[model samples]
Target: MTVTQVALIKMPAGNEYFNLLTKAGIVFDYIALMWLLALTNGVLSPLFPIAYLVVMHATIYWRTKGAILSSISLTAGYSTIFAVQAQFDFNTTFVFILNLVFIWIIGVFGSLIVIRERKHLKQKEIFHELMFTDYLTGLYNHRHFQEQLRIMTRARQNFLLVMGDIDHFKQINDQFGHLIGDEILKNLGGIFRDLAEDYDAQAFRYGGEEFAFLLPSIEETRQISFFDDLYGRLSSEKFSKECLSVTMSFGIASSKSGILPDKLLGYADQLLYSAKANGKNQVKFESRYTYYYSKAKEEIAASKQ
Candidate 1:
């Protein structure tokens, strides 16, 4: 959530809230100076960003967009200053005057920090997004997909888990250049995402040419229809001139039972092998076969036809 949303949630809005926010804001200004007095334990050490208070204050002062809410958070964060201040008598205006002067100096530092923080925040957001995404396909990576599975299972939805493997993917890479193979993977990811995003289903890049789909709100017995629809979709989508319209072998398992994470995945893997063995471009469920290497060999032999 944005800082504004947080502020709105935590404090009442309007002039009354603004007053509390301003009080906190000023305390932030005061604390900045106090910390500089004994430079060691203060923000200047490892967390120099704290010393850059001028950036945050100035941004609020000029932007005025979330000024009130921002101040509320600033105040709440630095309110501990009251306890620290209680330790120092200072007993004079001298401390106050010095504090203001220190703030003025650091405002320059804050200005630099403000520009940099904006860029830093943008970078942080991108880094976090990349963590969820697969490099080969634009779909969510396996780690993120599994996380979603756990969340959905906890929510207790009737869901279909479809595991997909590209037919004869290694041969595609071997016959064509790896670069071309990669483009196919990337293209397929986009195709799957477009297909699933609207259905409240999620598509994921489980690794290499294997993708996963979680179709929520599926009825227990109608799970077969879900795979058939997906199979038809994949069979119909167009590809670039260099690439053929590829078919996927799918293993679909529906669970109202909601198995634990490891077991659920194991079941999906077994079903994936079943589909691969039964013949490429088919879907299966509840298949006990667990051998991937052998199933892959079967797929390779079948692909030559």
Candidate 2:
């Protein structure tokens, strides 16, 4: 019975079938105990109170309706044993009635405790979400970003850190307004969020107009393909009438063994600066290679002509 209780507690919640099976097991245990009491001709009657413990355990996962049903089932089973034994004396009858009342009371009280515990768990979840989430962009906040980076660094896990900044963001805000700029930022955040989901990566808003992506180590070709997709999507996004389009510059650095988190971030930041210096709306990597979108190259060539 102890092992059964432990297994039930360890089972993940919200599965109706599993819960039903556990409840059935508890009922079977009660029936078996009652059978023993009858076979012994009331010699084991003193052990009947163990039924209360079973009912109490059921109430943990069963909530109010389940608890009440479990109590009723136990009472019916016990009454059958009482009838079989023909124990109709005043003392036995009073003790049986008292036991039934205590079972109901314990079931109701145990359900109440379960409800309180659920509420506490929900509160904790909400608190954790607020702490780790960025309110404006809905990405992970900078604090979470730093913490995750530190964890990966401590574990010496290989990854790619890509730092991105919106190109000419201040100019856009000055030309249009902060509201339009904010909308642009929110849209870009959504794009990053989708990309993260697709790539099984983490994205964060690393302060104003800057974002970061932590991607698992992959082949160079795949990394370039990811950057190409990102650049294409950003170039196609349409903002307000005043602001036709926007672009971002990125700097990517691969993780190495024995490297500190701060140094990795700094190297990525430097690469980002290099992208901006060469021309906005491009990506620079630690390999000292600069990547440009095909359309961007054509546009640059056209402007030169």
Candidate 3:
């Protein structure tokens, strides 16, 4: 019974029908156990209170409806057992009525406590979400980005940090107005949101016309492919005006062992400027150590040949 209760508790909370079926099964088991005890010990078994306690505890997870159902079933079971085994006298009738009342009281109070707890938990979740989420993009905010970056650095996990900027964004705003610029930002945000979901990455709005992505380390070829895909997606977007065309430039820096978050961010920022200087609507990536190591290997191979 303890194992069964634990299993029920571990099950997903979203499946209403499954939870209902499992709760019904537990009630049936309790009823069967009660009947067995009544038949063997003349309906006045000392162990019956323990069974009632189990029923009440289980009803906590089921809420008010479950509590009411358990109370009715247990009361009916006890009354039937007493009718069959004991004579209907004043004392017996009084005890039976008291037991029914006790069961109902336990059910009502247990369910009420659970309801209160669930409401409190929901409120906390909503508060935390608002604290970490960006209002405009619906992505994580800058504060969360800093927190996650620090966590990754502390753990020494290898990753790639990308910094992106919308090309000629100030000019676009001057030409089209801030309202149109806002719509453009929203469109870019939607694209970033979708990409992050598809690639298991984190995207953040690093203030106006700037965004960031934290992606798990992958092969250079795959990283190039990822950049190409993002560029294509941005180029293909259509805004309210047919004449508007949007493009973004991005720079990625690979994490190194024991690298500080600030230095890593600076490196990516430098590369972003490099992309803009060379030409806009492009991506640049840097990994100094990896480049040197590969060069050394090629030199060694040539020397051996």
lDDT of 1 by residue, 223-259 (tens): 4445545655666666556666777787777666656
TM-score of each: 0.55, 0.67, 0.69
Model 2, 173-234: lDDT tens digits are 99899999988888888989999998889999999999999999987666777887788788
TM-score: which candidate is best?
3
Judging by lDDT, tell me the better candidate of 1 and 2. Answer: 2
lDDT of each: 0.64, 0.84, 0.77
Q: Which of 1 and 3 is ahead in lDDT?
A: 3
Residue-level error in angstroms, candidate 2, position 134: 1.1
Which 10 consecutive positions of candidate 1 have the poorest summed lDDT? Answer: 42-51
Model 3: weakest 10-residue lDDT segment is 288-297
* TM match of model 2 to true structure: 0.67
Q: Which ranges of candidate 1 are over 4 A from the true structure?
A: 1-114, 154-157, 220-229, 286-305
lDDT of 3 at 89: 78
User: Which pairs clash inside model 1?
Assistant: none
Model 2: lDDT of residue 254: 91
